[model samples]
Target: MSLSAHGAEGAITNALTIDVEDYFQVSAFAPYIARSEWDQRECRVEHNVQRILELLRQHQTQATFFTLGWIAERYPALVRAIVADGHELASHGYGHERASDLSEQAFADDIGRAKKLLEDLSGKAVLGYRAPSFSIGTGNLWAFDCLAAAGYRYSSSIYPIKHDHYGMPDAPRFAHQVREGLIEVPVTTLRMLDRNLPASGGGYFRLLPYGVSRWMFKRVNAADRQAAVFYFHPWEIDTGQPRIEGLDRKSRFRHYVNIDRNYAKLQRLLGDFSWGRMDQIFLPDQQAGAAVV
Candidate 1:
């Protein structure tokens, strides 16, 4: 749909984007071990994604499911299941490689492979992407142009925060346009002490009390703005999954923190906001809602 259709409307409906992958597959923890090790155990992730699909369907909500191409190719039926439920199928890359970790050409190739794989599976245009770990920060801004050239309408890779890894400290928290005419939907953040912190979703959604998360979204909407684009992964709700060994104390904390709170919090979010597809959440003068896993 054209932004012109909602040109003057205030506070666009919120978007709920689910990155349908296991938490173990996230790029943050990938450096601790060989991906081939995780590759050996795939069924856990598959089952977790299936569970998310059923949950969203039960809520009667349509969300954007940014799926990894590796997962899509292996679980073609899962991709079909998402589309069958009227959800958006966006690329979450072939594997969980960080865009910054890959050279521009390599990132392009990765995204290209994922786009082709996902489109072929869903039989629909996959016009959106969310980098693993929000890895497409300032250093890899070139990735945006690559996405636009690859026929992607939007990306949600620039997490506007000050983390030790993978955040653009100066990036906008709201959606905006980028070079090559591609729109960049940045991950959400809140102003804290003049610095924008990542209270957008994910671990924060799990870490913060439900009241905090609910109030933040309500605050953004009350300011006459669109509801913030929120995201999380299926593995987040599966607290029973086996934890990886060799991860640092901090990595373990960030990954495994607040696993059980995710499901109930998500249900609260669905009840509180009218979630829409990412493309529909695209605001005029800004871009689409790009989220992560």
Candidate 2:
């Protein structure tokens, strides 16, 4: 059934997304681990993702997996498992390369390669794309054009909050059209005291109390009257995964803080909100004639 069909009057069905990547592939560790060395690292993604799939299955929820081509290539069956379980498959680029770090041609090539690969593997037309680390900004507004040209219908790459690494503070706080045929869905945030506060999830979800996170989503639904887009990496749920050393205290905290509580918090999150895949929540019209998964 479609998201609209599942909801009551004025009920908001938020988007639940997973960034499918391993522990070492995170941007925080990019300086420490090279892409060439990615193969040498121990892979914990398959098990972590399986755990996620099981949790979602228990909740009877669906989500979009913004996967890396690198992971899909190595774990094709895991990719198939996600599709088999009635979830949406989207591109998170081939190598988890940041959009801002790549040239125009390189970015195009990366997304193009990843999109084709995922579509071929899943036997589904991948319609969404999210840049690694929410890296697209004003300088790369052209990335939207690139996405449209590459056959993507929309993107969830921008974060409206101000962050040291990535953010387009002036961007739309919710989903909106970027180019003629492409939509840009910024990560959900709440406006309070004239500033956009991080509400959607990730480390922020881990760092903040569950009550605060719950209140943010409640406000977005009750006051703003819009669906919230929440995202977290599969690695977040794997508290037992190996950790890197020699990092600064801040990096250590950002990556490791609240690791143990993630699963329970996620359980609460899944129950607190009505969740659905990104395409289902944001592109219902485009998905109208498509086969139900």
Candidate 3:
């Protein structure tokens, strides 16, 4: 049930990732959020995530939830709910801060805080992390050493594309080893001739119709040698959230463009490919003998 099929047989085993954060809580939304006005709006994010939980449960699928330490501290019940449902839990840093905003020590402290909080609440080892907004690229690759030192096994933080906000234009597409014994599971992209297209499923998928997402993903499989990782937030399907203010037209368009159609499109994806956790996708080839856990 990992994201690609098991990364054997020349393709990926299925793996699903849930980045649990509110719409108002994303770093992109931070600029407009006055700290004096923020708190756990449990009504919005928690309630909406329960919808995601319902979908996964309905499909009997288990996923890796990259959660905010801020969310966990305020919503311990929700954290417990995810763990109790047998889903894997991972970190999304503390307070939704980006890796670039912190010094090396600050980032390490944030990771530690999140890890300790998640472990204490869920009673499980938090082995994975994802920097907010794909914030670990060329200049900030040093964050990897801190993550590995903080006892993380893998990170899903590199976008490997040139986005206005973040990306590592020259990073590898598939999973590779980092300097700190950390595995880099970069977002999926389809390479055509010399171009790396966004096959790592995300807002691009939500904005487009199911046919487009399906077509591009199929092309990724047909061309690329492994499973293309797909990620979407629970709020992407929650069309009823309050319309935000202070965003430019581009942010407004990207965030809310195809809300009505996304759920149906997601239903299509749920049926299209097998979905599981990171632990499952990166499962070693037993036939090849265990390299390391």
Candidate 4:
């Protein structure tokens, strides 16, 4: 679990991550889509992930896939394909529940289940975990203790912004050791106008113009000189996925804004900056532990 910067002499290698979950599983849609209804919904994750893999292949980039245990159990081959294509297979917990909502023991069980499930499927030690909707914060700092006890070496679960739903604005903007064995790599952000702006991707990446996103990331690299952690979801690229009804206006806008144009923007992003897996950038000494299975 030793850490060292892995960027080249003049270029910083940013961490590119994908949260592998279906569109129906978004935290905002929880009120509309019940967990029991998850099985009845048409699964698009397999196809969407295939497209993502092809996109990464075309760019010749490797990334970290924070895959859900639910998705992995159902789409085991998809997980294998990600590993076979040389990406890091990390856990996104088992059920997509927010860490802040779970008791420490419940959170521990969720992470443990996901780590074992992902490792059993991919034959790699699952070293990373991202909470659903960036749900880990000051209120649930014990989640880090759970992660460490569950054998996770790092977490990308904290979003350092002032958001209505999830963010710890005062947290470190870059990776830092939060516990004895675990590192907390908050998603990339830009400090501006005495406030932290969301630059790392997700809804913000889609909401802002491509130029704005690009400028923010470039600033982080040139000004901060730190490896920026950018994340997106498989569902973000699936414009054809089934739409959920009864969503409030804000939820609808946040989930579907500019999704049709996201894939192309992602291509531009891949070409614009250097990208690599999370562990390779942040935990340079640890191998991804890829295995054939």
Model 2 stretches astray by more than 4 angstroms: 1-6, 288-293
Say which prediction, candidate 3 or candidate 4, comes out ahead on lDDT: 4
- Please, what is the whole-model Cα lDDT of each candidate in the order they appear? 0.78, 0.90, 0.78, 0.91
* lDDT by residue for model 3 (41-129), tens: 43477887788888888887878899999889989999989888878788999877889888999999999999999988887888789
Model 2 clash pairs? none
Error of 3 at 36 (Å): 3.4
Worst 10 residues of 2 by lDDT: 1-10
User: Mind giving the per-residue lDDT tens digits that candidate 4 earns over 1-293?
Assistant: 32324355778888999999999999999999999999999999999999999999999999999999999999999999999999999999999999989999999999999999999988888899999999999888999988999888899999999999999999989999999978999899999999899999998998899999999998988888788999999899988988888889999999999999999999999999889999888886676664523
Order the numbered candidates by TM-score, best leading. 4, 2, 3, 1
lDDT of 1 by residue, 1-293 (tens): 22212224553577788887766677667777677776677457678777778888888887888899888888898888888888888989998888888998999999999999888877787878999888988677789889988888789888888888778889877777786567888766777689986667888887888998888777766653655778988888897888788888888988888897788778778887777777766734433333321
Tell me which of candidates 1 and 3 scores higher on TM-score. Answer: 3
Q: Pick the candidate with the highest lDDT.
A: 4
How high is each candidate's TM-score?
0.90, 0.96, 0.91, 0.97
* Root mean square deviation (Cα) for candidate 3: 3.9
lDDT of model 4, residue 106: 93
> What is residue 230's positional error in candidate 2, in angstroms?
0.2
Error of 3 at 276 (Å): 0.9
Q: Residue 73 of candidate 4: its Cα lDDT?
A: 97
Which model is ahead, 2 or 3, in terms of lDDT?
2
